[model samples]
Target: MNPPSLSFRARARLSRSAGALLLATAGLASLAGCANYAGIRSDKQPLDVARIDTAQSLPTQGGQWPTMNWAADFGDTQLSSLIAEALANNPSIAEARARLDRAAAYAAGADARRYPRVDGHYSVKRELYSGNALYPEPYGGSWYTENNASLSASYELDLWGKNSAGLAQAISEQRASAAEEQESRLALATSVAQQYNALAREYALFDVAQAEARERQALGQISAARFSAGLDTQVETRVSDTQIATSNTLVSQLQGSITVMRYQLGALLGKGPDRGLAIARPQMQPLPVSALPDNVPANLLSRRPDIVAARWRIDAATQGVTIGKADFYPDINLSAAAGFDAFGFGHFLQFGSRQIQVGPAIDLPIFDAGALRARLKDRYATFDTAVATYNDTLVRALTEVATQIAQIRSIEQQQHDAQAAYDAAAKAYQLAVIRYQGGLSTQLQVLDADRALLQQRQTLVTLASQRRDQQIGLIKALGGGFDSAPPPRRDALDAMTSPT
Candidate 1:
């Protein structure tokens, strides 16, 4: 369509209409920012299925995530000690704590912006005047200097809640930052647990390798003796040597694994990975037989710190929209200055010399074509992005819970099957050995049965280890019972105790 040309009055009317529309749009955008219509829907959809009752909650019991002491769950005192050390000295945790402090300070500053800013001032000077002075003049000059000092104070009245919105946004960001720090802590603790478990498994593997190597050495000696007596062939002796060599090679590989794990443990504890800390070999805990909670997936909203952080980000974005729209309206600020004024510093302390001033100032945007329009659009887009992010995080959290549940169930079945197989193969190996001694079975048959039994045993051990690790992962994913802790009442940023 072609644009229409207009007379002066018509253009003025059109401009006013356009301004009104822009202001209206900006106001709507602000509403959109403060309220997460999309997030509410998303949150509600899950709540219907999960039956979440936020209002009916009780205080956390003693075994809650924050209070439970996860290390104690494993019955490992050494693991507990290591975790304590990591919490105290880990660089990442320290950095996160510093950031929390910074965020809290920023929130405080934002809040204080709404209050009056007061300051004291003082000055002293000799006067020189170019023009004739009513009282006295030191010299006739083109320039004049005089001393006057006064204390001043100013305040911006948040008539439209703009300052309030700004403070709210800062507070939301502070909460988000705190949640992020807790997430980091959970990640750090999980890494330490996983690494410690890996080290234990490697140590077990090393022990297994050593035992196999000794067995192979004994078989090799027996074969050598038999060959010298002309009862075994040279090929049998060669096979025994090969077996011994393979077993020794495996032992060496396991030793290498032990060294690497030791270095990693050292690094995780914030010691130099290679040389700062001694590698104290820890006793591995037996696999936990505890059953997982049936309502694990439903508890994610309460447990996951990242999800909570995302929601706070959404709230902050919403408040940002409100603040942006408020900008398009007239700003009302109340400023006042009150101070003692005197010709000399000695009179500054006298109340009679004080001068007081007070007034309200209004800033009306007369002709900034579309600056506020553009800003409102930007805030709308940011709000949309925050909503999207929140939805995405919610989906991921659900998937995590489901995945851990499935993994744990599957590993349990695999462990059971592996145990049965190991038992059967062990019996077969015993029979084969007895037959070989009676010259009824070949050495190869005995070897095959023994290898099968070893394979089953190794698979069971690996599966058991994996099952334990998965349990730890599931607990970590569920925010490790940290959700049971009460939220902070203070505006100051506190250490986050959320899940990763």
Candidate 2:
């Protein structure tokens, strides 16, 4: 016998059950066809500060990180002002700032993806119907106008954390850009200070050259008098004239170098060469001796802008890997639309012309010739590269600090020895001049003493310049007074991918 006819309520219940069964079967089939991403992962890891050997080069006590106004310690107000100007107007600084803004904009865009997207659309068209096939009677061969207006909305379920991971990645990149901007500022400021120090060295050498020239002119006069009294030959006067000419040439070279240095300083200040001309002679005090701060490599991660930027990039790459993994799962979206459609304007707003749709859309990643696997592999590789770069930056930063410290120490000793030598040479030149006047020594002896004194003076000036330069180098290596909190730990990053 045929089954009994079902009541309306029973038929409705039966229909609901069938729909649920169909949806469940489809979900299982989708899961069975999903692409596998089991073993593809990044193996690279960041370097541990404790594992790297510091070799006792960096002192772990009695030191502090450089202050923001570390340049003031050099007692040069002009240098500080120039650094400030460069930070404000340098093209590199501007570029970095623009990049930061771009990254922030990208981050904002990514954030917007987490919320529902709504769009409004309207269109009108006039068309002629064919007299064959689907059209019939009066409708056939008739011209009609169509109107459509829709308001549609969609929201991703984010069950697999794809949207969240993407937002996190964008935020990390924004932070990295911020750190890089600071890095640019530090580089520009240090450059200005180093160039200014070089300019001061040149000026000091110029003064010595001018004094030597005056002494050579006096000696030339003495040689001419001796030759006229038959005490010396024309050879002596000619040698004295050559020495005076050499001194004048040195003075001229120093003057030219000073001008070039000023031009360079002007460029660093983001101005024309004329701007550098306005810079006054630097009245720098003695270079202050500084020791390395405590914690050595451990604190360097936060102290160095480059290192901080690298770390942030690694965080961004980590999020990229999360996003890649998320792609292997299903993407479900809830979408709804309400609209009006009509053949003519008379019926466009009528209730009978209203249309509505609401449903969940699912996108399953099935077989695609290994495209998904390849994408995941690329993300893993990118993560590995970011980790490697961070490691390299850390090692390089530590090496720079150690190298500058060694140089500074060596320069200090050299400066001490050079000062003593300069004092002795000065006394010897004085004695040689008195002896020559008393006819106890030859003109050649005074000339030799004068050459020794000039050589010593030049050495002293060069060492002083080197000391100042290395001091600046050490400051830069120590992160140029950059200070910031450390990036989020690994656990924090993992928390981002966890479901709410």
**Best model per TM-score:** 2
Deviation (Å) of 450 in candidate 1:
2.7
Clash count of each predicted structure: 2, 0
lDDT of 1 by residue, 266-365 (tens): 8889888763247577676765554544454445555788877877777787677678756755565555555555655666556556665555555655
What is candidate 2's lDDT per residue for 167-224, written digit by digit as tens? 9999999999999998999899999999999999999999999999999999999888
How much is the lDDT of residue 35 in candidate 2? 84
Please list the residue runs of candidate 1 whose C-alpha ends up more than 4 Å from where it truly belongs after superposition. Answer: 1-68, 130-145, 274-277, 340-355, 484-500
TM-score of each: 0.79, 0.91
Highest lDDT: which candidate? 2
Off by over 4 Å in 2: 1-34, 228-230, 491-500
